[model samples]
Target: MAALKILGKSSSINVRKVLWTCAEIGLDFDLTEFGSGTPNSVTTPEFLILNPNAMVPVIQYEGQVLWESNTICRYLAARHQRTDLLPQDPMARAQVEKWMDWQATELNNAWRYAFMALVRHSPAHRDTAAIEHSVREWNRHMSIADLQLQRTGAYLVGDQFTLADIVLGLSLNRWRASPIAHANLPALQTYFDLLCKRSGYTQYGANGIA
Candidate 1:
């Protein structure tokens, strides 16, 4: 089989999610950087052909083009039949997918403005009030994750680590790195500490990219 070709930069959290997933599955892949502070290849005609959204983390696997970070992780896990990473049972799969979706949608959306303003320091996102509001919301969403971790007392779904942890782990790193006040969510803190022990998190997540 041809090695998977991942098009994204190492500094990208979304791209790192895919990279960490590959590490967990012990799959080899080739990565091409197309992230911030580079010659914007994502907008180029050739790259745009692979992903209409022109996003980083677009992948070419088994002659099929795939985009969206979470979706790419799901495809790779399922394709390899890595039931440990992505469960085969329907309800178990849904449990993993639920947190993945939350990370992609609600959690991600909650932090955008604040992240751009405080982390990226983008001038266009300098609205003080909006940044404060975004920070509060971001913390609130993370609290939900903290509660879930408390309930599971291990990985997001249960004892075994799954795709949910792969996604949420990156989000947790982002929250920690972001320049916002955080609540005393001990469960989340414990969860983050647990994730840090993994080789994938050491290489791709805790590398101080965020």
Candidate 2:
């Protein structure tokens, strides 16, 4: 099989979702740097012709070009679904897509603030008020995820790991230690612990690279 090409940096959670999706599907990919507020090789004319945004995670697969993290993940799953990252039934797949959209519209909206404060800015230059605000909002959003997990089980799609779990897992990657209080949520903590066990996450999680 031809190896997939993903344009993006490893530090990006968005990129990592596609990378992780490839891993879960028993596929390998080549990633080019494109994010982290730094210019990347994908900005070249040849690359720009493929993805105008020149964003990391614009993937080339099956002779086609695709962008946006969740969309890329879905494409991968739909293309090679034998591994079960995506469901076989249409209803189940729709449910997964809904969670993926939530990851984009809801999770990213709340988490980016905390991520900027804790990961992007220097501790000395960090804004206490902004960080506090983000923490509250993130915690509140996390509660929603927590409730979902409690109502279901170990996985977001209910039992087995699916693309929904893979993508939502990426959006919440930073919450485990982002100065947020999650002491009351055992299910959420379990999900984090489970993700840490994956080889891709272990290699990436280690070194604080993401």
Candidate 3:
């Protein structure tokens, strides 16, 4: 099979999600930097042809073009038959996917404002009130994850580290990197330590790009 063709900048958390998944699956890929700082990227006609949304982290494999970071991660895991990352059992898969979706939706929404303000240093995101609100919301949603970690006493879904952990771990890295004050969540701290032991997390996640 042809190696997967990934289109995105390496610094992107979403791109790192796919890279880490490939590492776990032992899949080879050729990545082209095509977003943010890359000249004539995302907005270029060629890139828009690949992803109409003009987002980073687009992948091409076996004549199939895929976007959406979490979806790409799921597809790669399923395609490679890495059942440990993405289970075959419907209920078990749902358990993993629910947390992934929560990370992409609820957690992402909570942190976007503050992240753009503090990390990206966006002029439009400089509203002090909005940043504080986003930080509070981000911490609150993370507290939910901390509670789940307390329950499972291991990975997000259970003892096995699934695709849920890949996404959430990156988010946790971002939370730690952001300039906002953090809540005292010992469970989350422990969870971060546990994920750090994984090679994938160390290479792509904890590599300090967060």
Candidate 4:
């Protein structure tokens, strides 16, 4: 099969999600970075033809075009039958998918305002009150993840490292790199350290890009 073509900048957290997943699955793919620190190439007419939403991390796999970072990761795992990263059992898969969804929706949404204000410094996100609220919310969501890690005593789902870790790990990296003040989360800290041991995390995740 041909190498998957990924469209997105390496500095993007979402794009890094796909890159880290490919590393975990040992999948060979080519990346076309578009929108790193300048005007987004996603809005270009040619790029829009690939993804109508004009988002990065779109993948061209075989003859199919796919978008959504987490979904793209799931597709790559399933395609390679990497059940180790994504289990095949119905219940096991659901367990993994649950955390993946949480990271994409709950966790990701909680950090947007704070990340935009403190990190991206977006003019539109200058509401100090809203930024503080978002920071608190982001920490709260991360605390939930910490509790889960405590329960599992290992990865998010259990002893096995699944797709859940891939998405959540990237989010954790962002949370750590963000300038927002965070509550003490020892479990989360240890989890981040553990993820760092993976070459994939070192290369695509913990590359000081935040």
Best-performing candidate as measured by lDDT: 3
lDDT of every predicted structure (CA atoms): 0.92, 0.76, 0.94, 0.91
Q: Using Cα atoms with residue i matched to residue i, what is each candidate's TM-score against the true structure? A: 0.97, 0.85, 0.98, 0.96
* Candidate 2, position 53, lDDT: 86
TM accuracy, model 2: 0.85
Q: Of the candidates shown, which would achieve the greatest TM-score relative to the real structure?
A: 3
Compute the lDDT for candidate 4.
Answer: 0.91
lDDT of 2 by residue, 1-210 (tens): 677888788887778787777777778778767755556676689778887887767888778888888888888888875547777788888888888898788877876766776777666537778777777777788888889998887888687878888776765566775656643767888887887778866655432654
Model 3 local distance difference test score: 0.94
Q: Write the per-residue lDDT of candidate 1 for residues 69-170, one digit (tens) a residue.
A: 999999999999999999899999998999999999999999999999999889999999999999999999999999998999999999999999999999
- What lDDT score goes with residue 153 in model 4? 88
Q: Count steric clashes of candidate 1.
A: 0
lDDT of 4 by residue, 30-114 (tens): 8877774655578889889989888888999899999999899999999999999998999999999999999989988999999
In model 1, the Cα lDDT at residue 115 comes to: 98
Instruction: Name the regions of candidate 1 deviating beyond 4 angstroms.
Output: none
lDDT of 4 at 71: 94
